[model samples]
Target: MHLTFTTLAANQTHYFLALCLELEKQGYSTSIISFHEESNKLIADAGIKVFNVFEIYRIEKEKNLNIENEFSALLSKYQIECPNILLSHEKVTFLIKDSIQLKEKFVLYFKALEKFFNELKQTHQNNVVLFQELGGFASIVSSFYVARGMGYDNIYFEPSFFKGRMFFVKNTFESYKVQENFSLPIEPNVLAYLENARANKTIVIPKKDASHYQHPIRKIVNTHNIKRLFQKLFSKYLSNQKEEFNYIGSFVYRHIRMLTNRFLFIKYYQPIPSEKFVYYPFHVPMDVALTVRAPLFVDQYYLIDYISRNIPNGYSLAIKEHPAMIGVVEYKRIKDLLSRNDNIVFLNPDINNHEVMTRMDLLLTVNSKTGAESLMQGRKVICLGDAFYNKSKSVRFVDNIDNLYKHINTALKNNAPNIDDINVFFNSTYSQTHIGELYYCSKENIAQSSLSISQYVKANYGK
Candidate 1:
């Protein structure tokens, strides 16, 4: 079997390298398509074939082939719906501000990816698979579309709701599904984790290193990252590298904006209200969880305003910043929402999420894990977007926002989920998930994750 790994960062590069080495022992060959040049060098040093995407883009650009009707033709040829989310990726919008430039660049990327995938298909045929870390960035998204168009088996991986487990799916930002008759015995640890979460205790997941938020300044001052920053600076100015993405520039801009917003808006956050309230936690901006999975709720401020206007008369809508985005979100928009909506209140970002859930009458979310957490706590939840736990008996999935009030009322009137139903839902999830971490690159994690992945491929693809 031949595996092609897509790596966008240093951590992912390390993780994929470990997977490649482990899988090689089992007679599988591996290659890499790296979006970051630093990752490309690291992969190459490991004695593996690595293709840099920028080099591919440059090669395709030199052809100067007409792509005037390529986008429409590609869609028709591949039977793929227009990939709006790929074009809307933050990297594309941030780097190419002009509309004409953006379209030209996208067409060039599409052409390059199509040609690259054609060659890969010719070489590996049905023996190849593509692995991508879950993301909404341009390169990954474009690659996914092109690979699917060329009839390749591609899997997107992300950390699951359970600790130390990962889920894989084929569609961008889609959740994994288990057979309706899934009958695996529920793991005792899964039950224990649910009980602990119900008691308002912290529950750790694979991607989380700690339960608390780390300040942006602390992240910037780290020795390894500082060294990386310097290396990137040198590469940008002193080297002849043609990079598609500016990692250092994006990092600096994000943190500077984060710090400025933190200083200016800390005073505006209020405590969770004593009155009866329904909670709405903010989703991280530019996160695939929002941009790809729930594009309708991308402007959360508007969603909040709509929710506040329709919520039951006696209940207020309590909102909080996502911990990962404490200072990263735009405060002016939040300020405008707060000023206009009297029924809405901003909770301090420092408040423990479980504590807030315990005090709220209901939870409202756009595909957030908090919806799952709220269900564990026996709190009624109304989901405004696609979520892995949307099938839970405790959740009310709202298909249309115009009828938001009707759903809210229905959820508020419904009883808490039965323990048996919760068990069944989680047991189904466990049946679908493989025991592993996504980005954690510890030796034990690497071994376990690689074994799980290899077993899955062997069973599914007979490789």
Candidate 2:
């Protein structure tokens, strides 16, 4: 089988290369569709066929191609039902505010990406598998739709609820839907992990996973960031490097906003109150979990306001910023939410999430892993979006926001998930998940993960 991996960042490129090396050893052919020149060189040095997306777009642009017509043709050829999916990417919306401009850029991206995939399909025609890290970037979203339309079996991988494991699925930003006939014996490690998490009343995040929540100042000052900053500057000004679509936004403005929020918002955060409340964990801004999976809940401030106004009287709506979004989120928006609603209270982001969940009357979320964690704790939860665990009898999924009050009350009245049911749900999850970490590039991890991934592919898709 031919595996084509799509990578945007340097770290992802390195990780994919390592996986490619391991997969190649198992007699599987691997290639990469790289967004940047540096990654193209690295993959080429590894003696792998590397398709440079930027270079392809540069070549295509020199011909002065009509993007509107090309985009329309591609859409018709693909029989794309929801063309709006292309515009739903967070980066696309974040970078291009003007509606017309966003559509035009997205069309240009579609034209470029369509050409890239066509070139790929020519070289590797049969038994081709596409792999991408689940993200809310325009390229990732576009490629996913384009691949599906072209009859390629595309797989997306993301960090699973269990640390050191990853969930692979065909659906965008959703859990693997296990086939009806599929079943695997529940592993003891799965039970042990859940037991430990419950016993300690804490979730043990892998160091690699926790690294995303590093302080913004520290991240900015890091040697790697400094080097990357210089490289990007050089590429933009001195080098003949084509401007990548992902880098169209101003990082300096983002950094300034993040830093400003970090310093100014401490005063707004209040202690977790003793009063009865419903907890709403803030999602990281621009996260695919929200941008793609829970698009309606993208405006969290609006959701918070709606929930605060609609929930049963006397119960305050408690909220805490996601640690990964500490300074990244807009503090002014959060401040405005607090000012507008008397019952909406802002909690310190540092407080133990499980601790807060334990005290809450009910947890409210939009496809957060915390919803799953709460279910593990047998706590009441009201999910407003497409969470993997929404199928669990424990969760109250709000299908219509108009009936938010009814859902909230219904969840409040419902019993916590039975331990047996929770076990059953996890057993099924364990059966579908592979033992590996996403974006964890340690040698030991890569070797073990590659073995697991390769074995899975062989068992499921090998001819």
Residue ranges of candidate 2 with Cα displaced over 4 Å: 91-94, 99-105, 171-173, 177-186, 204-209, 242-249
- Which parts of model 1 are misplaced by more than 4 Å? 63-73, 91-96, 171-173, 178-183, 208-212, 242-247
Per-residue CA lDDT of candidate 2, range 1-463, in tens?
A: 8888887777788889999998899898888877766677779989988877776566666776666676677678767666665566644336555545455555666666777678767877757778887877766877787777668877888777777777787745565543311245657887898899988887656555575576767767778767888877776667756434335346656766776787788888888879889999988767777777777888888888899988898899998878766777677788788788999888877788888888898999998888888888888888888777877665777878998898888878777778777777777776767778766789998998888778877887863
| Worst ten in a row by lDDT for model 1 | 91-100
TM-score of each: 0.92, 0.92
lDDT of 1: 0.76
Extract clashing residue pairs from model 2: none
Candidate 1 lDDT, tens digit per residue, 1-463?
Answer: 7888887767778888888888888889888877777677778888887877777677777876566565566657666575565556564325334444455566666676776677777788868788887777767777787777777877988777788888888655576644423356777887877777676567454563442256666665668667877777887778756444555677777767877887777778888899999999998767787877788888888889999998999999999988766777787887898889889888888788988998999999998888877877777888888788876665787878898898888878878777677777776777788888876888899889888889889888998
Inter-residue clash pairs, candidate 1: none
Q: Tell me model 2's lDDT, rounded to 2 decimals.
A: 0.76
